[model samples]
Target: MVLPHRLSPMVSAFTALWKQRASLKTLILGDFTQNYLASYLGFAWAVLGPLVMIGVMTAVFQFGFRAGTTGSAGIPFPLWLACGMVPWQYMAEGFVTGAGAITAYRFLVRKAVFRMGYLPAIRLLAGSIIHGILLIFLVVLLFCYGASPSWHWLQVVYYFCCMFLLLLGAAWCSAAVSVFIPDIVSVISIGVNLGFWLTPIFWNLSMLPENWQIVMQLNPAHYIVQGYRDSLVEHRWLWDRPLLAHVVFFIWLFAALFIGAQIFKKLRPHFADVL
Candidate 1:
């Protein structure tokens, strides 16, 4: 049973987790040290990783697929690709990192002050630090591409928050489930790889026939990819998106949040038992 609180389970979990804010921040910092600081490549991996991924994909699209992603009249393929790539990497990292939170910190599973629910948030925090660095790199890239500074570029903040909400909601579910099922790590690994292709990061939806284009819009990541392009490439405001797109995106997001939160709350009490 969920704790005896009249507040919504999500609200309760969040509030409890908030009280441990310092520990959460410290843990996330330690995660950075643990993951990268001791390594030879060190912090350089953050920039190199995205650059290499882009290089590999660009090679494929240019040669393998002969795909011309010249990007909306002015943006060019590289800038367009960066916008979609950074946010998608954020979400993908959030899933993998958050899913492993519980097991990685199994020793703290029994600690009273360690509100287990904060595990996902802690992981997300670590990932976001790297994402923020990437965003700066993207800005430099855009300038180099001669994509003049525009106010629409600010809309990336809104899209980042949207992606954060979606990731957190999904993370809760993944973290909780993975605690009881170790195989979930592998499942999430495979799933993210599959999702990367399904998401419209590498290819443009406009490449598809009109009928299939409508269906592609249904993929929740499409909203984010388009939103990033809107901010950087298309120069469209968030409100300028079609009403149907807005409705569909929010519905998809909230469904993930609602379902994930319920699963998380139901399983939270059992976390220590399993770990």
Candidate 2:
């Protein structure tokens, strides 16, 4: 059967990524080596960068602001903050870097044989490498806080997939657009910084009034952050959340993916000229 012309680029992009998975792995590793080659600490920065950020935030909020354990579960504020911050750092880095994936690899874009589509995925996967390490740190923190492993802990995989897909969609769109308008990268950086506070990473939803809580839940990041807390701290299953929460998150996720694909498809032909 033939795919519709409109869907061909999207289907082909995914198919090519799978076929070239080996090359993708090589490119991702190359990025890691190139990134830290100049630093004395080398690849360790991947782990230390986030750990330092989380440590400072924990200090400022848990100690300076005296923001006690914010969740209803009474998990240590530092642990709760780490759970949210770990996944968030992954998303934030993916957004900022993925937006520039096209321009960053213009040489590949110029080559007729290479697919520019892989650039965004390369950025995302590279960030995932670091994300996995941070997750280990989060698990150790959880153990230190006396939190026992539970079946709910498996939901971290679900939430990680959720974030990856959401970021991929957003990356596809932002990356394609940034090729033409370089300013989009700075715009994304600003948005991610603002999103850090707006998404309730350090704060709990219960602190808000019922109506405000409903409004805040519409932000998809809220679902992922809260999902992390649920999996690691609260021991609640995905179904334990209100139905509306699930619906809102998937709606945003799918919408982002569909729209991002369409935009990337339309703008893809022009990438070579612009870049």
Candidate 3:
């Protein structure tokens, strides 16, 4: 009585999950509420958490350690750092969370009735909310600093979508691989931690010798971080990215998605056995 699915795996997977979208949304929203909004000023913690860290970092670097004191244009170091950090916070969350999605919901994986390919999409849904709050906080800080709004600032929306697309692709790869290699979860954690310092978030990329810039730009997160700072603090357009940067980012993105989809479909049937 098992009728084989005639649709392509991707289409068949979507066909299975499409009907559950409503329930899934409700489940995700409910989880978000419980985790971040259930207590007094609970959700407020999301914004306050990063703001506090940024403040401490600013104070430490500007006073105690005396690093990243130089800011681009007239923008302060903290402001510039915050703009980049906002996107990174969301991006890191998606990647880290997605990597554990399969293991975290092992019960669902065993059910064999649920469509697992959407795990990456589901991982970042709640994260986008936190990203919005951080965006507002960044804007308020800029306004308080007497920065004027400009047409270029409007490109944050484009950059937001850009980061999300990047997140989707990365999430797919991380989620799929981690199911097979549990150590990938730890790898992602250590990688994100190390990547923060390695990336040009706290320090400007210009600090490096001009010749070494492309090497650092190899990290796709660098492109997004730079995009955020350029849009918010430097007032640059989305299309203004260098040609090579565009080529590298798109290549990594599409490749991640294509390979991720293939791996996800191939190993998906075996999830129950391992889980």
Candidate 4:
């Protein structure tokens, strides 16, 4: 079936990427290694960096702020916090790095044969390697806290896919636009930092009034964060959440992908010139 003219560019980009899936894998793995090539610990930093951040955040909130007393589903506060923080680290890193994906590889942007479309996915997937390790750490932490594995744990993959697609859309837009407006990278960085607090990583949504909770749920990151807690700590399925939350989350997800794709496609032709 023929796609509308507006969607053809977006669809074509995906088609090209699939055709070169092997190269995409090589690029992602290569980029992931180069990310830590100069460090003494090498790839271990992928696991260590986030673990340190989680440890520090857990200390400050659980101990310093006395937030440990509030546990979700009787899960320990640290475990609950890890569940949220693990996915959040992926989202935050994906946004910051993905925004710069195109700029960071400007040499490739000028290559006529290169598919610039793969840049954002390269950064995102590279970061996913780190994300997968952090997730393992989270599972061990949960087990240490006496939380047993359950079928609901499988939902983490579903949530990860949700977050990945959401980021891909946003990344395509930001990476494309950042070519012309360099400040967009900084803007996204600031937004992600603010999003960390605004999102309920350290706190629970139940702390808010019912009406306000609805408002907070509108944040796409809120859905992913809450989904992590539900899957790991609360042992609930995705459908178990309010129907409205699912609707709102997907609304944001598709809107991001659709709008981002159009914006990326529209600006793509000019990227070579800007770079």
Candidate 5:
């Protein structure tokens, strides 16, 4: 059943992917640089975009519905929201935009040697870099409020890897599907939009009803939000002790990657035809 090349194409694909790390980085920074260069504001918008959204959400939540219930008064709820939203936004944006990446570049997909999957990977890398810069800006903004940066803050790197893999897997599936079903892009947009409220971004997860709290525990985004809170606000070690949920997250991560990779591989051959 197996048409084995002396070197499996998948093995070669992995090596190609790793070797193209510089290519990925170049694409990320290149796209980001070009986009910002078009405007006078430039990269300021990177920091400003999230800041504006946080401000708008803060006003609506803090004033209209009284949703500014994070941390405490000493730590403004806007900053707390930023702590969670920064990463969530990256995941959200990466999933939405990366989903359509393959179809968006049909010309490139038609190229004989082009790897279609890398399209989504490049999109995610770009989004992650922007999010990384926004995160550093968050640190400076937090300092303005007298929050001292602790060595524990570096733990974001570990959590970021987890978050990136989560997004990458999701992107792989969505991008692959989008090639066959154009409608998938619309569905993904709706899901990302809905995910914002479903996950605990503006409010504390602990405040949910006991049953709902238990139910929401299944959302991987919850763990990511908790990771951010733990590393930044709680001034504590990230997920100090592993539990069933951590196991579930790893299981979910592996399962998603496995399924996504298989799905992407299965569908890849037909992409040029479909696109």
Candidate 6:
């Protein structure tokens, strides 16, 4: 027989894991089904959506957003934009979806013990799969358009891991707050909008003046977007030395996960009641 104390966390974790397995699987299947349900081309829309956006950004920026800088990047402007868009989309969608994890399934939270944790995990997984598919499509498109990967492509794996950890930490915090104040979801919506503008999406950071560049460094997404462009387009390794800023980000992520879990546990009792 197993000891109660020894098996407690494992048992709790496992029960929650099993509860979510079906929901998570269903989420993936449902997303794929619904995403393509109305389209004449079905799943082709996934590829087409990003490609179309890539085309629009390229055209508008190449014409309207022109700066004096050139050749700072190794890839074409469209390919460079695609590289940034693919990962940034993942991060944004993951956080937005994760933020409402608790509110989405109010019934389960009211009835279950460990199930709350799985909601965010499932949302993250769903976003991850979508992002992964988009990345693969981008790679194939780039290759077809004559963009070849060097040893730097090897760094994609590392960048992906970084993005995952960052998402996990951020998602936990967002989900935690969502349980207490449903308005957190709205706040996140506005925040993501601001984040998109703050981030170097259509334009390169080099285009910014020196003082503004220093300010942009404070945004975690900035480094991450730059990291993706570096690894995929620039073919560089993950940052070699951890800077002071990165250290601060790592600390924030850790703190968010730790504090968020406790907050989730604390508020979990009332989730069902509120819902």
What's the candidate order when arranged by decreasing lDDT? 2, 4, 1, 5, 3, 6
Q: On TM-score, who's better, 2 or 3? A: 2
lDDT digits (tens) for residues 1-275 of candidate 4: 97888777677877998999999999998898789665779777767877788789879987898775564545677787788888999999999999999999998988888988899989999989888888888888888888788999999989999999899989999999899999999999999999998998888778999999888889999999989888888888898898999999999988888888899878889988887
For each candidate, give its TM-score against the true structure. 0.91, 0.93, 0.86, 0.94, 0.87, 0.80
Give Cα distance to truth, residue 139, candidate 1, Å: 0.4
Location of the lowest summed lDDT over 10 successive residues in candidate 1: 1-10
Clashes of 1: 0
* TM-score sort, best first: 4, 2, 1, 5, 3, 6
Once fitted onto the true fold, the runs of candidate 6 whose alpha carbons sit more than 4 angstroms away are 1-47, 65-74
Which candidate leads in TM-score? 4
* Clash count for each candidate, listed in order shown: 0, 0, 0, 0, 0, 1
> Counting only residues 3 or more apart in sequence or on different chains, how many pairs clash (N, Cα, C under 3 Å) in candidate 3?
0
- What TM-score does candidate 6 get on C-alpha atoms? 0.80
> Of 1 and 2, which scores higher on lDDT?
2
What tens-digit string does per-residue lDDT give for candidate 2 at 198-262?
A: 88887777889999989999999999999998898888899999999999999999788878889
Q: Which is better, 1 or 6, measured by lDDT? A: 1
lDDT of 6 by residue, 213-250 (tens): 87887777877777777777676566663476577666
TM match of model 5 to true structure: 0.87
lDDT of 6 at 265: 60
User: Residues 1-275, candidate 3, lDDT per residue (tens digit)?
Assistant: 55335325545555655788896797578657765789988788876887887888799887787664455666777887798789889887778887877777687786666678766667677778888889988989999988888787878887777777677667767787787899998999999899988898777788899788879999889888888888888877767778899899888776666666667777877888887
**Judged by lDDT relative to the true structure, which candidate is superior, 3 or 4?**
4
lDDT of 5 by residue, 1-275 (tens): 55455334344445677988877677667656665656788668766887899889899888888754566445578778888899888888888888888876788888887777677777787777778788887898788878887887888888888888777777778898988788988998899899898998887776878899878978888778777877887776856735876887887777666667667887988988887
CA RMSD (A), model 1: 2.9
Cα lDDT of model 1 by residue, 75-106, tens digit: 56667888889888888888788888888888
Alpha-carbon local distance difference test for all models: 0.83, 0.87, 0.78, 0.87, 0.78, 0.71
What RMSD does each model have against the real structure? 2.9, 1.8, 4.2, 1.6, 3.5, 4.5
